[model samples]
Target: MRLATGGIMHETHTFSAEPTAIETFDVARGAELWRYAGTNHSVGGVVDACRARRIGLLPTFFATAVSTAAADRATFEAMAGELVAGIAAALPVDGIVLTLHGAMVAEGFPDAEAEVVRRVREVAGPDLPIAVTLDLHANIGQAMVEASTVVVGYDTYPHLDAAERAREAVDLLVATVEGRIRPTMALVKPPLLPVPQAMFTALPPFKTLFERAHALEAAEEALVITIAGGFPYADVPMAGMSVLAVTDADIQRAERIARELADLAWAHRAEMVIRNVPPGEAVAAAIRHPERPVVLVDVGDNIGGGTPGDGTVLLAELLAQGAQDATIFIADAEAVRAAVAAGVGGTVETAVGGKTDDLHGPPVPVRGRVRLLGDGRFVHEGPENAGVPADMGPTAVVRVEGVNLVLTSRKLMPGDLQQLKTVGIDPLRQQILVVKAAVRWRGGYGPITRHAIDVDTPGLGSVDLNRFRFEQLRRPIYPLDAESTW
Candidate 1:
């Protein structure tokens, strides 16, 4: 059997100020996509699954970028055009495999992933077996469901299971093409917009919830079950939690199982709440917590969910609280340039962070000595997306009072430890560390973090859903409306 592979991935935050331009993406063409084979990303899983089955593989085109604002119309069209063209060119394959994020939004396109599937279907025809793997935080729409043969999502929230999900997608596609099994899928969305902070799958409430899902999957009637804690930042009509069940040619059974899971999630809606402490209180708690290096999660500046990585609210609080031995990353290219000019061991006074937009906070004045400088590139040492290459562009480490400011030229998710070690700061040695992320930061810092506090700062990824007015959302989602019913 042979298969063609390609995809575009992004988690769009509609309220974010940043725009995802085509030029900002990391585009991989043809054989270049194979480089991800050993990584923990979904693309890597595609490569691994194909090799294990000895199936002939043809790589097409893949484009992705870190989470950010919705792509402009032109950007989406250009990328989608290339992806479909590449798949069409790699014709005569037995099947096709696609990796996409479910929460992707573009200008004039609220259901972007569905649009992608429809375009692929136009070229692949009605009978071709097409399989897809998506992020767990997908806001799944019905359009993609009817077009693709099978759709799968990661089981883990920190998304350690991304590659695993892709592998499963490939397996299902191969099985379908060989006539070994006919797959039928059903989707259900619960009207809940829970924050990522409360969605960690390892320990819950969520852990208990996923266990029940596992039980359903183990039953002979179901092939797989997916629980997607939808990306809430995207103000699309489908923005909420979703449950999916895939069965062997049994649509009725799939629908029944999916609805069961969805009902369960709705019943537990109150438990899936975001508990955010004020920035001042969060800093004070971090300072007083006995645990060395308590992780202070700046939910408003969440890089993984697409906020500017330079929110200064926590930094301002740290300064005000007189916290000691703390470390936080900020993205400010001009500040980095200034630090670079100051050279290692040179003192420079400059304003840093909150430069992307006024929503995060204003830049704070700080005089600090530049301790280190680097190109700001590192390999991900992760349970999530492990072995992927991450670049923060030009970087400089500046020590401001008792705080170590690791400034970068680009916005990056704090999902890996090497992102910090590359700048000569050992995270384990710090008393407090600030991560501008929601749930994914746990893949790297959870092991050493003695305690974690979610801070409520005002930016695009804020857990408080009411902060941004939603015009596109399906009316009356929970918390936003207390009377909202499942």
Candidate 2:
């Protein structure tokens, strides 16, 4: 059997000020795509699954960029055009597996992933069995469902199971092509908009809801159950929680289960609301807590949610509070360049962070000795993107008083421990670790963290939806509009 694979992956934060230039996307095609084979990303699972099944693989175009603002029309057209053209050239394949981020949005396209699928179907013919694996935060739409045969989403909120979900989708595609089962999927939107902080699979109402979905799957009532919390930053009609259920040639049954799960999420909407503490109070709480190493999550500067990595709100608070052995990372290429010029053991005075805009806070001037310099390339020491090599660009570490400011040239998610270790900072030894992320950092920092606290600063990735202005969202949404209802 011959199978083709690849797609564009991006998590668009429409409210964020960060612009996603075409150069930000990492594109790979043909035999060059094999580089992702052993990584823990979704594409790694596709490569691993095809190899395990002994199927001939046709690698196509794949493009992935970190969370950022919507792509321009020119960039979006180029990416989708290349993806469709690559699949068409592969031709005569038995099946296709696609890796996509469900929350992707472009300048004019609200449902970009669905648009890609539509274009692919137009070229590959309607009979091709196309299976897709999406991020758990995907805002799944009716258009996406109609364009593909099977869609599987990651089960974990920190997205630790990307490979596992990809394998599941590939297996289902194989079965569908072999005439073993016909997959029928149904979707339910429950008028809920929950933030990433509230959707951790290890906690609360989300955990219970996932348990129920898994129970149904174990009982054979559903072949696949995807509970996407949706991306609140994307101001689209489908920017809310969704429940999708797939059954064996049973559309009605899938619809019934999907509606049931959607209702369950609605009932727990209030409980799913995320509350964060102010940076000053959170730092005080972390100091008073009995834990040796507490993680202070800067929600406003969440790199995973498309916020600029240089927010200085929490860092200023940490400095004022006289916190000891605290560490924070700033994505300031200019600051790194300054540090590099000073060289190791040389004291450099430079403004760090908050350079993006006045939203995060003003850049704070600090004088620190340059401790270490690096190329900012390392493999992920993770249960997250394990075995995947990453580049943070030219990096430097500056020690300002009691805090170590690790500066990087690129915005990066704090999903792996090696990001810190590669810069000579031992995360375990620190009393407090301030990270630019929401909940995704738990996959890397959770092990050494004695406790974790979320801080509400001022930026796009704030847990409070009231902080943003939405022009495109449909009327009567939960939390955003108090009178909204299912």
State each model's CA lDDT, in order.
0.90, 0.90
Note each model's CA RMSD in angstroms.
Answer: 1.0, 1.0
Which clashing pairs does model 2 show?
none
Query: Over the stretch 1-486, how does candidate 1's per-residue lDDT look in tens digits?
Result: 889999999999898888789977999999999989989999999999999999999999999898988999999999999999999998888999999998999988898988998999999999999998988888988887888989998889899998988999998899899999898999988788888877899977578778888998777768888888888889899887888888999999999998988888888888877768999989999999887989999999999999989999999999999999999999999999999999999998999998889999999999999999999988898988899898899999999999999999998999788888999989888999999998889998888889998888889888888788899988778868878886
TM-scores of all predicted structures? 0.98, 0.99
lDDT of 2 by residue, 112-206 (tens): 99999999889888899999998988999999999999999999978899989999999999999999999999999988888888899999788
RMSD versus native structure for model 2: 1.0
Off by over 4 Å in 1: none
lDDT of 1: 0.90
